[model samples]
Target: MDPQTDSQAADGGRVLIDHAHEGHFGARLRAAREARGYTIEACGQALRLPVRLIRQLEAGEYGGIDYQVYLSGYLTKYGRHVGVDEEAIQAELARLAPRQRQPDLVVTGGVSHSRYLLERYVTAATYVVLTAIIVVPMVWLGVRGTLDRDMPRLAPLDASPVAQQDAPATSSTSAAAVASATQPQAATPAETRPEDQQPVLASMAMFPPLDHSAARTPLATSAAAPAAAATGQGGHELTLNLPSASWVEVTDATGQRLEYGILPAGTQKSYHSDSTLDVRIGNAGGAQATLDGQAVQLDGFRRANVARFRVDIRDGKAAPVSY
Candidate 1:
């Protein structure tokens, strides 16, 4: 609703300088809120913003898609609350805010269905795969055991010795029993092959082969091993990008200064280290960070007014070091 203009003295009377630039919009907001005797909380309550975000805005910390794109509206609301010139604030912000926040939704929104499926199901499928690896082999082995112990072994009637053949003058029931003992029937086509001293169950090929050692590995355990390997020292890089202006500081574990400067809007900088990196950002709203080429959360940086944290890579494991 309202915004900012330069104030000055003309002919000993207070005058609002129309076209003058008042540097750091944050300072303008802070001065106006203070002049009204309103705490940051009271101003935020009136403006419907969290107290921390109000503090960040007053500190000139705006970053990220949410912050940068919506910041103009926030400024308008803030202007209304403080009774500044809305039109003037919008004009200044138009000149100040970069177009980086208006991300191309069409480009990023086109996520491949295959990739989406992989992301959703890959982890769950690992458990199923690991389970099948263990269970399938056990099932096949149990089947083999039943085939060996329960299934009758059959030999041709001619395979019997001459003495046993000559001694058979049995009754009809005994003859039928003898015939059954000599002849075996197969229940399924999988077991229909003749077994006359050939290899045990000539076709165990119906079941998939099992990898005993691989089956023993739990999916969680195997996945953890790779994560640890990823964390080891060497080739660790910390990158910071500021879509909007923010104050930042960085130091290494060896206490070597890397970056201790105010980042201008719409620029990026990086530092390399072998151990840990300590980072402090005065304005965290739109800051993005990467550690070892992986996106890492700024962890309460944006809303906290100022964010400070440490990143550590040890024994092939990368983790945040809490401050």
Candidate 2:
């Protein structure tokens, strides 16, 4: 850099002496010290300089302070306290200061402005990755929610009288039918059935007769076989007619029990019955039945006429139920 042209303009061409000339920064420093009535030693004490060095600086000698930075600091402090034109002096110093450019050296040492740019890019990429990590699962959950809304519901295992009774067969047959229906085949045009297509068989089938009353085989004591057990012998029989929104329970001497329910008018498969060794029914009403020749008690929370009955069996016949 060259000497400051601006200082020339500001100070009306009476530029402070440069430190390199015979009477430069030292002469100006000496003039400031003398004006303040500071001897060389007094100037050294004020600015923390050695008397010999201060004399050397006053003579405009070089190489006293190895670093120009220390000279600048010393000049700034002395100039400020002495009420010099600090700005003009600083401008002159800036013009005279050594250049600090190292752009080529930075590149040669395997570090460059490009490295700073790449680090910024990597930071941006990391932020994008973190945002993706946070968002993907939430998006997945949203899509899953939408899918669930559109999907058909699975029937519960204990849904109804018919559903509970046919649960295993229904599942197996449905799986087989699904498999068969999906088999690869030629497309066939829709065809009209004959006007006199034979009537399809009803799904109902006869319950195989029980050979012995005490038999515990599944075929003998299934939900379908309960009616047959009542028909044959050796078990108590009770009839309960439950009103809508009601339930019924029946317990035998052996602690074996059964429960039944009736739901609202529009609900499908609303009736339920299950066999249990002990039974209690709640949240139902309006029931009636005979129990060992006495009336069973009735209790309820909603609509009435629900029945609870216990049976007594002797010689394989239903005894009158009792409460």
Candidate 3:
């Protein structure tokens, strides 16, 4: 052969060898992946690519994805994951120049596509339901708390009419007893005849009218009124004053609840108990108490801004006992 012919034959032989060496790059990758016991899905997951993308790549189809830098990177990663040499994959990618196809479109009647859509909608609806279940009760409880805090104060019950009518008569009789006891006795007579004293005693017993003005004297009445009012008719009076809003509970000795609930700022309440009063105060620092006109010191009994104590009434005197 001549020199030019020999050079042309050498070039043709080199081209053929290169084409043979780079033959079926995708097929080689698939064989390598399978030999390593990796499924297409596993290889896709390992390389962080979609299963469809992995399938298209192994089938030697370069559709759906951008073919420039992205395809090269994906192939390099997938080849490395499947134990294929990176440099060989890159060289094949450069030489093959795979043709690009149009991206696959979703068909309306496709089963897998419909299932995927349904799953996404179901997941979103589940999230919404869970959020409502968590948030709705919290909102309702908050509103209920606000309404309770702003509730109106209830009026105390009225006293019986019988007690009201008898109060004045009892006070007047007590005053007469006090007046008679305080008055001095007249000097006793030196001598008396039984016959003469009998007529005077008989006449006095028949008439039996005493002076009302003397018995109900202003001095005696004034002294008795305060003593009667301080210790109420059937019980001792207890007064509670709140400087700020606080919760209060009062129970009598009979286990009857007298007052129970929150008291607003500047609120004053009175309770009557014949034997004892059990009291609990929330926000102790803002509350003041009085029993039978005597101030009760609550600071000593406070714990965590709450105070609990019992009031005992004996012989018309009130004393507090801490609990």
Q: Pick the candidate with the highest lDDT.
A: 3
Q: Compute each candidate's TM-score over C-alphas.
A: 0.27, 0.31, 0.29
Candidate 3's TM-score reads 0.29
* Between candidates 1 and 3, the TM-score winner: 3
Question: Which pairs of residues have clashing backbones in candidate 3?
Answer: none
Clash number for candidate 3? 0
Candidates ranked, most accurate by lDDT first: 3, 1, 2
lDDT of 2: 0.45
Instruction: Give per-residue CA lDDT, model 2, range 11-67, as digits (tens).
Output: 797555444443566577778777887787766787787778767756756455776
The lowest-lDDT stretch of 10 consecutive residues in candidate 2 is 186-195
Give me the runs in candidate 2 sitting further than 4 Å from their true place: 1-20, 24-45, 48-56, 59-221, 228-323
Q: State model 3's lDDT.
A: 0.62
Cα lDDT tens digits for candidate 1, 1-323: 22332222333533343333434677888898889899987887877788887877677666532655577777778877987777657765664454434655564458899999998898899999999999999999999987765644321111112112222433356867666566656323323332232222111112224452342233213212211112223477677776654556677777875654444445466676677778887556668888767886876543345667888777876666667
* Top-scoring candidate (TM-score): 2
**Over 4 Å off in model 3, which ranges?**
1-233
